[model samples]
Target: MKGRLFAPRLVLLHLVFLAAVVASGWLGWWQWERAHEAGGSFQNLGYALQWPLFGGFALFLWYQVVRMVNGTELHRQGESITVPSATGHSESAGEDATERTTGGARRRSPVPPPAPPVTEEEDPELAEYNRYLAELNAAARSR
Candidate 1:
């Protein structure tokens, strides 16, 4: 069976989650001690709350780690995300549409024209960069 996976972004989020868990645990520990110093009992009911809350946070973090290891996609952008394409199906049609509608693979433009013309006079800096790139390309090709 074919399966789609978001490998890189998921791994990044897992790392973030791991860091958050460590930070939360350390803060929780620090807070617990601070509470103890303020005449709070560490072995009492008040102290019991800290362990469960911290432990729950740790468990939640661990669950995310497990999901990441199992190749689950993590959506950090607050949107309903689809599985990333493992196959090149979208590379053919989607890329062309993206190029036409959004301009190139980067989507730098908010809305791209169907066919945009290059004008050196309009943007001299970009034109210069383009010329530099062309020179680099020509030199690379000659090698």
Candidate 2:
């Protein structure tokens, strides 16, 4: 079983990115508010940029988290994933599709042999249950 905090490397990277974004936003907001008191236009630009920056960071972080949750091979064990700097999105998308298809195709169990039918006398409890079920079904259909 996985530990409570045993997040994969990709997930941890996303968390760290999220933390940096939050910290940067907080710092920017503090500086902006302070500069606004002193009447600086640069702080206005910084403040204006803050939301978009934070939003982009959040989107990237979300992508990483989704990849981790969906079992994308972002990293293996202690090694960092060697994703191509360009077109990484396509690679990840292909991996996601492949994983989903392969996962579904994996068989959980083999077909079992058919069981012999039991007579009413062989299992009184089963007979009673069947009678009760039939009664319930009849009442439902009547309703």
Candidate 3:
């Protein structure tokens, strides 16, 4: 029974799949015949046969795509979630871990507070230079 999904497109898909298979099989046969007649290297024979196998693979892929579009095939689908870090777990798992460690306390950022800015006065020469610069800036602004 034809479903509403891709009913029109199936004809085109079938044509393309048929073309691919036919071409691949022809190539494989040509390669095999060439190898048999002129003492061609085994490589040609291998490649020739590989063409037909490639065609078959194309057909297989098309079938898979159709099945997937119809919601019939489910393979290799995985569950992945965006995470801030490379801890190999999801946010819920991280929450559980935090609760385990903190005895069910609400989760909070573990980052430390920013350090206090260093004072130029620590170096007398630097402090003097900074004062001079500040005076220059003040004069410039006044002008």
lDDT of 1 by residue, 29-57 (tens): 76677666756665544554565577577
Those runs of model 2 whose alpha carbons end farther than 4 Å from true positions after fitting are: 1-8, 68-143
lDDT of 1 at 54: 70
- Using TM-score as the measure, the top candidate is 3
| Candidate 1 wrongly placed segments (more than 4 Å) | 1-6, 38-48, 51-55, 61-143
Give the CA lDDT, 0 to 100, for residue 80 in model 3. Answer: 27
Report the C-alpha lDDT of model 3 over 8-123, residue by residue, as the tens digit: 78778878888999899889999988888877889988898799889989889888867766543121121222344444554632332232223443333466333334367567
- For each candidate, the alpha-carbon lDDT, in order, equals 0.54, 0.57, 0.65
Clashes of 2: 0
Selected candidate, larger TM-score, 1 vs 2: 2
lDDT of 2 by residue, 10-93 (tens): 558667777777777776777667667757677576675675577577778677666665543322222223333243452332
RMSD to truth, every model: 11.7, 16.1, 13.8
Deviation from native of the Cα of residue 3 in model 3, angstroms: 4.0
* Model 3 bad stretches (over 4 Å): 72-143
> TM-score of predicted model 1?
0.32
Model 2 vs. true fold: TM = 0.35
Model 3: lDDT to the true structure:
0.65
